[model samples]
Structure formats: structure tokens, C-alpha cells
Target: MKQVFKRPESLIDVPAHFCPGCHHGIIHRLVAEQIDQFGLRDKTIGVASVGCSVFMYDYFDVDVLESPHGRAAAVATGVKRSRPDNFVFTYQGDGDLAAIGTAEIIHCANRGENVTVIFVNNTVFGMTGGQMAPTTMPGQVTTTTPFGREVATAGYPIKMTEILVHPTIS
Candidate 1:
């Protein structure tokens, strides 16, 4: 019989470790499908960020590199520049992309690197025990902000996509 229920050709056989309601698994499958549909599986290079999805390399059946905490963009830039023919992409979370790697993301976007970024914004830092992240909404309660985030002290969450569209960056 034909293999109709088998996993996608661009994804690994192993099950993901994300939470039941987490969207990482869906995003991973979408990326994998895109890689296969676009015939880029052989020439795709994925950069895994250091957040909950850090183990993204284990799920995709392609070349993957793990970036240091909040450095996926920098690593992706190098990979894309080094192999212009290959399709490079980065998987990052709100915390990884909006916090420690903020400068790197800004610089990479400003340079207009030919890379796709899959940014997952769940508000809080899921991997690090749900701490308040730069993307966490104001008044959101997290492990680090048990009493809800205070705009007066913690400041408002960073709007990454909006920032990326700035004239200087876009």
C-alpha cells in the first residue's frame, strides 16, 4: 500500500517536545512542508534559536545549526552570505528575537539578508519557565511577574514586526 499516513519527507520521525497547546509543532510542520514543496530540502539551512524551539534541528530533515542564546539572526546572516544559493531561515521565539538578540535582528533586517525568519510570539518566555519577555503584554502575569507586568516599571512590550518595518530597517 502507498504510505499515506507517513511523516512528511522534510520532517523527522521523532515526535516534538512542545506542549500540547503550543504552536511550535505546527510551525515546524509548515516549514518542513514549505521546504519540500519548494524543492529546497536539499538546499535549505535552518538556524535554531536558543528558546523553547532550540531543538528545532531535531525535527527538520535538513541541515540545521544551533545559535547561541539570542544569536540566530547573526548566525543566519553568516550562513546566507556564505551560501547564497542555499535558502537560509531562522526559527526564533519572542524572547530570543526581542530580547538578547534584539540588536542582531535589527542589524540583519537592516542589511536585508536574504533569509526568512519564523518568529513565534507567545508573549512570555516559555522555555525559561514562563518569565516575562519583551513581547509580554502589559498587565500580563508571568512567573517573574506574579503580580502582573507593570508598565510604570517594566515598560511596554516590544513590537518586533512593527520595529522591523521602520524605514531604516526595511
Candidate 2:
């Protein structure tokens, strides 16, 4: 049988801590592959937000900056602005981006910050024991919402893409 080997320059090693059926691993691989394909390993600067992905810095071989909860965008803004020649991106989960960092994201997108944001909307806060996130479904039950989320009180899930695509904003 022909043996398949890992990409020679890929940064990720085996043994990830993500849960079964979680998409984080796939996303991480995709990002790493893109970095390799574009020869961006040296020019890319990743900003990792709090939550499950807080340890992303350990996985990626490139330079990374750890940002406080809900503050990845702010940090990325500074990095990109300071080093405009480098590629900058943020990896953020729903709880970090849609919930705690809503204002920062809005302003960043509105201002057209020259950075990319990878927003993972898993519907629940994964790290904090699966609590209801701002993107959780209306009827989904979470640790914090044992009886299912009520739209009347909690309001609708914020569609971040929609918010970012608004004509005035984008």
C-alpha cells in the first residue's frame, strides 16, 4: 500500500482536544493548508480569542497573539494597523465574537479593517460547558437555558454575516 504522509510544512501535529464531530479541527487544517499554499507562514499573524481555541497558538507554527475574551478584533486591529504588510486574521467562537465582542466586531467591520475574521458559530458556548450563546437557536436547550431558549426574552439569534453585510456597514 502506498503510504500517505502529512504535509511537510503543515504546522498541526496529531492529537487534538476538540470534541467528537467538532469542526474546529477541520477549520484549523484548512487555515494551515492555506497558509502553506500561499507561502504565508512567515507573513501571517493569527490572533486567537478566548474560549476553546485559546490554545490555538500552540497548534499553529506561525506567530500568534493571545487576546482576552471578546477582544480578538481589537488586538487584530492593532496588529494589522501596525504591520500592514503582514496578513492578519482572528479565530473567534460564537461566545467570544457574537456575545461578548459584538461591539468590537461591528466597529471593526464598519471601519473596514484590513483583516480577516473566522467566526465559528456553533450555536452554544463550548468552553463554558455549553451554555446558550447569542447564536443559539430559538428552541435549543443549553446548560444555561434548560427549558429551551425563549425568543421573547432572549431575542433572536444575531446573524453576524447579515449584520456585516449591511450596505452601510460593508
Candidate 3:
């Protein structure tokens, strides 16, 4: 018999600690597949922020650096600059990327940094007790917002990466 199910070499064989129904585990698997497909696991350097992906180092068998909340892009930028040969990427959340690290990501994008950024925009902050995040939908309830988010005060959901999307960035 032959083994038909083969796990990505970049991912470790172990159970993940993500919440039930959470998409982190699935997302990690996809990222691992891409890393393996590109054969860049040896040179991949993952920058993890203070969100759900903080434990990315545990799952991916690659050099990973923990960055301050919302600073993963900034840290990845520096790492890529220092070692251009290395494949650098950042795994960030809505709160970290859209709210706190807005400046860093914008600058990083504007400068056309040669790095990959995986942005997970879950409306609520799952790791931080399900608090409302920048991408939280209007009228959606969260721990931070007891009676649902009021559109008048909270405004609408912010799509930070929308400005960066284009046919080509050069």
C-alpha cells in the first residue's frame, strides 16, 4: 500500500490549539502547502505578531520571530532588508494589521517591499476574548461592544488592504 495522504514538509505533525471552528488551522495548512510547493521552506522566515498566529513557529518548521502587536510587517521588512536571499513573510490579524500596525503595513506596501503578508481578517478578536476588531461588521456584537457595534459611533468596517489592491504593484 502507498501513503496517499502526505502532510506538508514545512508543517509539523501535531494537533493545533486553535478554537473549534476557527480557521487558523486550515489557513496554516494552506500556507504550508504553498511553502512546500515553492520549495522555500529552507529559506522561509515567518514574522508572527501578538495574535492567533503567535504560535506559528510551533507549527511551521521555519525560523520565526515574534513581533510586537501589529509590527509583524515592520519586523519582516527589516529581516528581508538585512537578508535579501531569505523568503520573509508576516502572519497578521485584523486588529494587529488594520488597527494598530496600519502605518507599518502602508509604508511597507508603498515601498514595494519584496515580502509576503498573510492577513487574517476575522471580524472579532478570537484570541483576546472575542473583542470587536477593525474589520468587525457593523451591528455585530463582540465582547468589547455589549449591545452590538453602533454604526453611528463605530462607523463601518475598515478594509485596510483595499487601497493596496491593484492589477499590478510596481
lDDT for 74 (candidate 1): 93
lDDT for model 2, please: 0.88
**C-alpha displacement of 6 in model 1, angstroms?**
5.1
* Candidate 1 residue runs with Cα over 4 Å from true position: 1-6, 167-170
* lDDT (tens digit, per residue) of candidate 2 on 1-170: 88685752657565787889888877888888888988989899999998887767878888999996899999999999999999999999999999899988988988889999989899999988999999999989999989999999998998998988772622
Candidate 1 per-residue C-alpha lDDT over 70-124 given as tens digits, one digit per residue, 9 for 90 to 100: 8999999999999999999999998889998899999998888889999989998
Q: lDDT of model 2 at residue 28?
A: 84
TM-score, cand. 3: 0.93
| Whole-model Cα lDDT of every candidate shown, in order | 0.89, 0.88, 0.87
Residue lDDT tens for model 3, 1-170: 99988889999998888888989888898999999999999999999987786878789988999996889888998999999999999998888888888888888888889999999888887787999987898889899998999889998988777865631465
Q: Lowest lDDT 10-mer window, candidate 1?
A: 161-170
Task: Answer with 2 or 3, whichever has the higher TM-score.
Answer: 3
Q: What is the TM-score of each candidate against the true structure?
A: 0.92, 0.92, 0.93
Whole-model lDDT, candidate 1?
Answer: 0.89
Rank order by TM-score, top first?
3, 1, 2
